[model samples]
Structure formats: C-alpha cells, structure tokens
Target: MRLGAIADDVTGACDLAGRVAEAGLPTTVLLPAPPAPGHPSPTTEHHEDVFAGGDDASACAVVALKVRTAPVGQAVDEATAAAQLLLDAGASLLYQKYCSTFDSTPAGNIGPIADALVALAGADGTVGTPATPGARRTQYEGILFADGVPLAESPMRDHPLTPMRDSSVVRLLAAQTAAPVSLVPWEAVQRGAAEVASAIGAGHTLVDALTEGDLDVIAAAILSAPRPVVAAGGAGVGTALARAAVAASGQRVDISRSQLPEVPVTGRLLLAGSASAATRAQTAAFAGERHTLDPLALATDDRALDRLRDALAARADHREPVLIGSAPEVARAQAELGAERAAALIEGALAELAAFAVHELGYSHLLVAGGETSGAVTARLGVQRLLVGQQVAPGVPWAVARSGEREIALLLKSGNFGGPGLFTDAWEVAP
Candidate 1:
C-alpha cells in the first residue's frame, strides 16, 4: 500500500477510502478482525485476504476501527496495532481519519489515538483538520464550523456519544493531550506548503482550511514533511492526501478505472441505526417498506426480535428494499437505560438482525446507516475488509465485501451524511 489511513469508525474509513479512490488510487477499507473466543473485541490481525480484485502493490488502504467512542487506552492500543500492520505492509504515509464533526469527549480517543500513531510512526507531530467543505464542515483560525455556524452552536453540540461543546480544535485537542496544541492559520496555509510545514512542530497542529485549495496546500505541506509522515483529518484532507501521494510518487492513476465491483443485487435492505438529524430525515423521506423498531421495546422485549425477523421473512418474495430502524428518541431510551447500555443493546439487536437478514434471508445488498451501527453489522456479518466503489454521495461510497462465495455490496453511510433521499436513491447505483 502506498498510503494508509486509520479511521476511528467504519463510516469514516469508507469516507476516506472514497476520497482516496477519487484521487485515482484504488483503495480498500479493512475492518479489524473480530475477537477470538474469550478475547476482547477489535483484536488486530494482518488481513492478506483484502483487496481481492485489486493489485496490492498499487492500491491504498484504510483501517477502520470501532474506537471513535471507545476508551482511550483501548482506542490507542488498537489504532497502534493497525498502524503497525499498515506500516509493515509498506505504507510511507499515514492519515488518521476521523469525523468532519470532530466528535470526541474531552478525554479523547482522537487526541490520544493520534498521539499513539504519531509515536509509532516516529513522526515529529501530526497536523489535522476536519474541514470537508462539501459536507458543510470547515475550519478557520483553528475553529470548526458546520454550515457557517460554529460547531458548538450546531447540531453536533447535541450529539449523544461525544457532544462537541467547543468549536476550537486547538482547545479541544489541548484538553485531551498533555502536549501543547498549535495552529497553522489560513495565513500560513495560503502562503503554500513550505510556510505551513515550517509551522509544524513537536506537538499537534490544528490546520485551518476553508476551501479545496487550502486542503491541497495543507496536504502538500504534510507530504513535504520528514519521512514516515503522519497526518489527521476528515474526507477533505484525505482526498488531498491521496492526490499529494500520487503526485509525489510520479504516479498516473487511471481515473477511467472507477467503477463498482460486481456483486449480487438481490435481497436489498436498508438498516438505519442512527438518530442523527440527517438519518432521521432520510428515514422520514424514504417511501418504501419501512419497519420501525422501538428502542424501548427492542431493549425490554424479546418478541421485538422475533417480530423483526418475521418482518424480513415476509418480504422474502418482495423485490422492493426494506428500511428498518430504531425509534428516533434516543434521549428517552438513554434515560430509561444508561447511555452506553442502551447503545449496546440497540447495536447488538441490530447486528443480530443484520446477520439473520444476510445469512438466513440471503441479503446481498445492504445499506447501513450510522457509524456504530455499521461497525456492529459488518462485524456480525464477519466482514474483514471492503473494496471501495463508486460514491453514491459525497463522502459515502459503495463498499463491496465477500463472505465465502457470496459477494455483498454495502453502502455504509455516516449518520450525519447524505440527503433525505439517500435510503431510496442509493439503489439506482448499486453494484
């Protein structure tokens, strides 16, 4: 692999992988192996089985870990192992990919995980930004904004897992790590790569980027840094990183090679498990066979599982896609059961249903919404890696995976990504 990215979640990994492929590098997204018997989850294992159809020597990779909200130490250890696997596989550049919202608590998985990757890569420090303009997320003067509003004043502030109460990346990162946090202002970024590179130091630098040009400048600066370079960002910088990597190596990626890999198209299902505003809108906008799982009922009642299973079974002969999701009232569920407990319960139930749909119902085309939901579903389906395919939305792509002889086409969408028609319109471009 020429460039490796360690993302905190499945959606982020697919998001970065899509950008990398857009830059003309054939990309793959690898999920960490499921734990062995009696072992903890997210145990790292070298996946030689990935990139099934692509040339390993020419392809890039993104390792998606279920650590966005995991405990700090666990996230660090898992991410470190993933980085080692990528680096040992011959990746010269490492990109730490997270959400454009910069989702994290004060005791971060982002800061600590980045610190670990930086140490493992033996880099001076990493520069990061969550500026994905197409997604309406951008940074200026080290402060994150969503659709022109400061992050703290935006919908992300009400996030269930990691409420972003502050918009300043410098302050948020400084609160999580003992090391000093620095900034590369737009002034330096506009001056070009050399000036931005000079601003980097032995501590994490939060670079400002409001446009694609700024991202190119920031990515060029990262490439020009010392060997074994490590950087961080969302999909915006990830695209730039891929471009810079190809340019630095004097490579000519065949853009015409962009096409979705062949996979089975039967038994299409849309599983929505996120309560984000975008996801809620998508669920509401979808005009199809929809089944809503009440979080409270699913957590407390066993028949909820049977009902959902029967619902899927009833659709066996139907060709229209079915949309299944939990109730949108996450706060009520969290109040009834603790936050983590409620999330675990819902995710576990959803994961079980996904496996049943794929294995028992013969589902091959799956659209999963939400980071945590996608992680659980993919793990339950025992998917180790995915081949990145044509994007159905900005930062959202069709990922193809194989389970034995069955090829599954998965479109894993972040809860906060995609339009209202995402759940319905995505099928028009299925692989």
Candidate 2:
C-alpha cells in the first residue's frame, strides 16, 4: 500500500476514503479489527483480498477506529498497533485522520496517539493540521477557524462529546504531548515546500495550514523530505497527499472500481444522530417525510420504538424516501438523563431503527449522520467491512456492506459536512 490512513471515527474514515478514491487511487475503509494474540498481522493486501473483495485493489487502505474518546492508554495501544500493521503493509506514508476542527479534550487521544504512532514509525515528527476547506475548517497562525469564526466561538462548543472549547491547536496539543509544539504559518508554507522540509527536519511535531494551497506545501515537503514524516489531518490533507504521491511518481495507477449504479429516489432511509448545527439544519430542511424522535419519548414510552418502526415501514410501503432522526434536542435530553446515558440511549435506539429499516422494512439505501451513531449502527448490523463505491457528494460516497445475505448501500456523513440541502440533494445522481 502506498498510503495507509487511520481515521478516528467511521464518518471521517469514509470521508477520507472517498477523497482518496476521487484522486484515482482505489481505497477501502476497513472496520476496526481486534488485535488478537498470535494472529497474523492484517496487511492492506490481506484486508483487500478478504473484506474488500473485488477486482485488483489499489495500494491504499483506511482503518477506522472508535477510539476518539476512549481512555488515553487504550487509544495509544491501538494506534501503535495500527501504525505497525500499516508499516507492515508496505505503505510509505501514514496519515492520521481526525475531525477538521481537531476535536479532542485537553487530556487527549490525539496527542497521545500521535506520540505513540510517531515512536512506532521511528519518524522525525508528526504534522498537525486538520484544515479541510471543503468542510469550512481551516487553521491560520496556530488557531483553528470554523466557518471563519474561532472554533471555541462556533456551534461545536455545544458538542456533547469532546466539546472543542479551545481554538488554538498548539495549546490544545501541548497539554497532551511532551513533544515541542511548533507552528508553520501560511507565510512560511507559501515561501515554498523547502521551508516545510526544513521545519520538519528540525522537529516540528505540529504545523498550521490556512487553505488548500498550504496543504500542497506540507504534502510536497513531506514526500520529498530527507527523513520520513507522517502526515495527519482530514480529507483535505488526503487530497494533497494524493497529489504529492502522483507528482512524486509522475503517474496515476490504474483502478478498476466503476461508478455506482444510479441512486433510486425511493427506498432510501436517512438516519441522523449528530447534534451539530449542520445536521440540525439538514434534518429540518429534509425534503422527504420527516419524523424527529424525541429522546425523552424514546426513553420513557414503552411503544416508542415500535411506533418509529411502523412509521418508517409505512413510508417504505408507499415507496417514499424517509428521514428518521433523534437530533432535535440532544442537549436537553442529556441534561435530563446525563450525557453518557442520553448518548447511549440515542445511539442504541437509532442503531435498532436502522437495523429494522434495512432487514425488515426493505430499505436498500441507508444514510447516517454522526460518528458514534454510525459506529453503533454498523456494529449492530454486524458489518465487518465495507466495499467503497462512487461519490454521492464531496466527502460522501455510496458504499456497500454485507448484512447476512444482503448487500446494503450506505452513505456516512460527518456532523459538520454537507450543506443545507444535503438531505434533499443526496438523492441526486452520483458525481
């Protein structure tokens, strides 16, 4: 594998994998596998031959993990193992994919995991920039901006898990790793790729990217540097990495996966659990029959689950697209039932609803919006891996996974991704 990616969440993995596929390098996002004792290390080739079965698979693989908010020690161990396996797969480059806003607590999985991966790779240092301009997240002068506003002042402050209350990436990472946090501003990056190489050679574990151009600089420098350096960030970074790989090699490898079949307008079910403003807006502006389940009602009412299933089933019978979600009042429910309990209730309920929709309601396509929600739904459906297909939109794809004897289509979207018409426009022809 030429490029091996490790994403902190399922949506983020799909986002990165889609970006890689768009760049002409066939990529597969594998579900997390337990690091079993005495088991042969899972390589990119082995995973593609087994889970990602199809035509000749490319040399890029993305592994998605649910360790975004796990305990620090556990996160570190798993990341180290992932890095070792990717290296074993013969990938010359490793990218740690996270949220565009660099979502993590002061006591972090980001910093600690970076430390472990870097130590395992025996690299000079790891770069830090989650600037996915497609998602409206950028960094300049060491501060992260979300839609032109500081992250702390954005809607993410209300996030239930790993609320980003800080805008300075350097400060946030400093508290988690002992490595010296350095900033490579846009000015230095614009000077040329050589400056970026100099910074990495001198040991700058963290850098800054203000726009798409800056990502090019970082990628070029890393790919041509004297010593190997690990690239880290969101889908934007993956784009630049693809460009750098092609530029350095002076060619694009052949890939066989064709565009997905035309997406049918009906028999589609949208399930959203993200509480972010983007998701809330998309949910409210849904063009299909919308049913917003109240968490309180879902938790207290004995028949709430059955009622939701019946409502979705009715839509299926009529051949109409449906949007069923519990995203209206997450904070209120969290306040009533506590954060952990409320989140668990919502995730569990949505996973159950999705299972019924796919197997019993006969929905062919499933759309999920959120990280924890996707993890729960995929786990409940017993999907061990996913076969990537064409793009539904930027950072969104129409992938297929096996559930029993059926192959179900899916689109997993991150909280901050997609525009206002995302829910409605998702049914449009694949790009």
Q: Please, what are the lDDT tens digits per residue for candidate 2 over residues 1-431?
A: 38888888888888888777777776777775544576533223335342234564555777877678878877777666666667776777888887888889998788887777777778877875888777788888888999999999998876888888989988988888888778787788888888877777333355577777888888887777778677787788788888776666676643334754344433677888888888889887886688877778877998988888888776635346688788566778888988878778888888999889778866677889988888888877867677676666678876777767767778888877888888888766432
Supply candidate 2's per-residue lDDT for 236. Answer: 86
User: lDDT of candidate 1?
Assistant: 0.83
Please report how far candidate 2 places residue 341 from its true position, in Å: 1.5
Q: Positional deviation of 374 in candidate 2, in angstroms?
A: 1.3
Predicted candidate 1 versus true structure: per-residue lDDT over 216-288, tens digit per residue: 9988888777544578988898888777767767875663365556775668888888989999999999988
List of clashing residue pairs for candidate 1:
none
Report clash pairs, candidate 2.
Answer: none
**Clashes in candidate 1: how many?**
0
How does each model score on TM-score? 0.95, 0.90
lDDT (0 to 1) per candidate: 0.83, 0.76
Off-target runs (Cα >4 Å) in candidate 2 are 33-54, 201-204, 250-257, 261-266, 316-318
Assess the local accuracy of residue 356 in candidate 2 as a C-alpha lDDT between 0 and 100.
Answer: 92
- Once fitted onto the true fold, the runs of candidate 1 whose alpha carbons sit more than 4 angstroms away are 37-43, 49-58, 226-228, 248-259
